[model samples]
Target: MKAWQHLQREPGSAVADPDVLQVINACAPRPSPTLMRINGRVVIAYSRTRAFIDRDAWEALPSDGLLLLRVWPRGTSSSWFALTRPELERTFDEVRKTRSWNSVRHYHFRVFPAALEAFRVCMTRDEAPFASQISAAEAGSESEKRGSPVSPSH
Candidate 1:
């Protein structure tokens, strides 16, 4: 079975989330072999041979959106699949024609890997605590690098 199919089988899988479903429905005329998955707060969209979002657009998403987490296979080239307004369809068409197999594979493996890892991690424990721990650790590291000391009380 396809990886996407496997992911969809779980009860709380992102595939079943209402928000994601809404987005998928709005996106219209679903493409074959689904390349996107939406969890409560995040959206994972893939392109067969390229990444779905460009860096500038990605950086613009609010923390809540967290769009396009992983690209499959790793080391993939990325471009914007969803353009603003009038250019959307034309941009998608341009991408469909220019994307390569290797590029797509890289996107599938790399960009989405972190999200997949997070899902696996979430399945094992109360993800909020773990996520908090990770955030704390990252903040600590950042503080250290800046030559600042973090106090436990803070």
Candidate 2:
């Protein structure tokens, strides 16, 4: 919800999705790209429940739009990542070549903390400035200072 609000505040920005209400109200974790945005360029936004991404979601990604990934662990602060279409496709190809499908027949692309260094525009990096300073537990304090959009109790 904060991501959506932040995006909408940008000039020339517009966002939409048929399932936004469902996504927002969902009680369980789900694959994402919950909304689409046009801010000089089109972007598909996904607020992920974990650092890992499913192959089904990757394959379903649209070729024409950029991806805005929000990695938010439950009860923790979130980080933002802006992935280009080519990068998203390239990563999927790389994952397919080196990783095997699980029993469910889908590849799992996991982005553990160290791997986050490879992504562009990760908000956590911006906030911490140094990897040593990066801590999810501490993120809440920063969010509070910045006036978190979500209620404190949430």
* TM-score to true structure, per model: 0.27, 0.45
Q: Which candidate has the top score in lDDT?
A: 2
Kindly list the per-residue Cα lDDT of model 2 for residues 57-108, writing each as its tens digit.
4554456655555667789976554555565554444455533644343444
TM-score of 1: 0.27
**Candidate 2 has which clashing residue pairs, if any?**
none
Give me the overall lDDT of model 1. 0.30
